[model samples]
Target: MAALFLTLLLLSSAAQSAERTLVFAAASMKDAVEAMARAYRERTGNPVVVSVASSGALARQIEAGAPADLFIAANPDWMDYLEDRKLIDVESRTNIAGNTLVVVTGDGAIAPPVDPEPLLRSGRFAMGDPAHVPAGVYTAQALDQLGLWEDLRPMAAFGENVRVAMALAARGDVAFAIVYGSDAELSEDVAVAYIFPPETHAPIVYPAALTANAHEDARDFYAFLRAQAADGALGPYGFTKPAAGSGS
Candidate 1:
């Protein structure tokens, strides 16, 4: 009986060790990543833990000694940041998905060639803070290209992340918001006021990679996400799958 109990304890310990993996991803990746985690869990009987926030914040957290095994960044820049710090496994990095930037209105009708002066005079607009959030970075790029950044600068309400900016727009607390196209799909309360031209700013690409300290299981999960991108499983969540033969 004593021998059997010891064996059982060892088995439990191995199982626990096999189950440990931590994934840090962008806020925009919330629903889709959760669904992918569920599918992986069902298939492998191993659970994936996810922490969702701004890509920059997650990168900083990882740099600060956070135990993240995998990271999915909203853009290449944050991944580049981690790479520059030598925190990521260079060969494991891959382009997982893409997104579009748009302006959404919580209430009232607003359209293309958005006249920022009138809207700013009436109500505040929401944007993720350009300092560390990719959505805001894209928004700033687009607005500046459109020649509206200077006029609309002071009327913007900055949020910690893109989802929060979308929420503010959804609640009608902000007249409009700049967020991912996928975000507009999440909230019925808001509508796309305008789809910014892709050329207006740098392409919004989601790049993913494993941390240098990642466990073996993390490699499997990282591969799973890339396969999902290939399988088009992430399409419903508003992610653009890697094109065929693009070698994602």
Candidate 2:
């Protein structure tokens, strides 16, 4: 009888493991994704495991065989990297959401249309590392378009990801930071001081796809993302739904 009970326990454990879906997502999507995961769980009774970090970092991990079933990137570049390497299903890729860049301050007191020049002159400015981070790249482009890059680059403080940059400003480590509007919305310590003109940079879009070796079960979760996004689950978090019929 004891042997039969042990056998039943192991079978149950295996069944549970089989129902788990692993997702690798950019850090900025953390809050929205977690909420989606919970809703999915309530509806499907399947467990979802989420790993959030910089898009660059997560891409490297997936390349190194981290076993992610799906990936949601903050920018199209990282998704392109994986797709180019045949690490993701090209046909499965789709634009999921959109975001805007904003200059933020620690005290939520700074007003809109801020002049970053004077702000950066006396203190450090925080942003993601432009070498690979999307937010940093967008910030660089906007600053260059406004001809502020040459002057502001000197006082720039780099973070591994947008959230880290936002944290720097939120913690008073820097005078200001540029982060996704969604990120600033979630942080009480920070306020949007200025919104970067979309014309100054490439469109900010989030793309999601199944990994090359994605478990068949992961497909359901992938579909859930589309369904939830369509339902405007990300709206309250300050993310815009992808334009209808937009491809990755």
Candidate 3:
């Protein structure tokens, strides 16, 4: 009888110890979030399961009951979508990081252009699909500000996400791509051709929050992500700290 009791206790303990948090994050945040998840696991002995995709897709998945505990979006619109639907804990929403757009090209395949229009007009350039991808939306905003969106629309090759768009540039399928600055730093096959000025579009922000039905471990992990440890991990991956007063 004692042996049976001991076995059951051990099984229960193991089950409790195995609890993990599920995080849905934007594709662009893959590196930084994975690094932070590793650090969190080491520090707390709790595992974090990460799912990466475009913010729009992730949001729809969450809405369809994907069972994500936490969500990190590359832009506020997706977070707002959930918040408006009461799918996320509004009080927990906070902007955690910032990013900027850059033009990238296959290494040694194209020269950086001083005037972006000529290169964009000369050959197809890759961009995220502005209909849903935040990176593409930002790229569209910047191009519009430069008065190039309409004229260059016909030459644009749209990708489902920033990584897809960047890959097209890296593969030399397109002359250049507009993607997050952090993405350009990650690949040896690609090089930054130009950086859009900050004023060219709205500031890029990464907002993180717990889902409305998040478990205790999710809340703990969410707190850890808002602390200094996460901030340290993000910087190495080209993510900038959010400016003071940045909102979700």
| Candidate number achieving the greatest TM-score relative to the actual structure | 3
Candidate 3 Cα deviation (angstroms), residue 112: 4.7
**TM-score versus the correct structure, for each prediction:** 0.91, 0.91, 0.93
Candidate 1 residue pairs that clash = none
Candidate numbers sorted by lDDT from highest down: 2, 3, 1
Candidate 1 lDDT tens digits, 143-210: 89978888788989999999999999888888888999888876778888788888888878888899
- For residues 124-240, could you state the per-residue lDDT of candidate 3 as single tens digits? 899988887899899999999999999888989989889999999889899889999888878788988788888888889999999999988889888988895344767778888
Compared with the true structure, all predictions reach lDDT values of 0.87, 0.88, 0.88
lDDT of 2 by residue, 1-248 (tens): 99999999999988965688999999999999988888888887888889999999999999999999999998889999998899999999999899999989897676564565665465788999988788888899999998889988988999999999999999999988999999988889998888887888888899999999988678998899888898888999989976454466
Candidate scoring better on lDDT of 1 and 3:
3
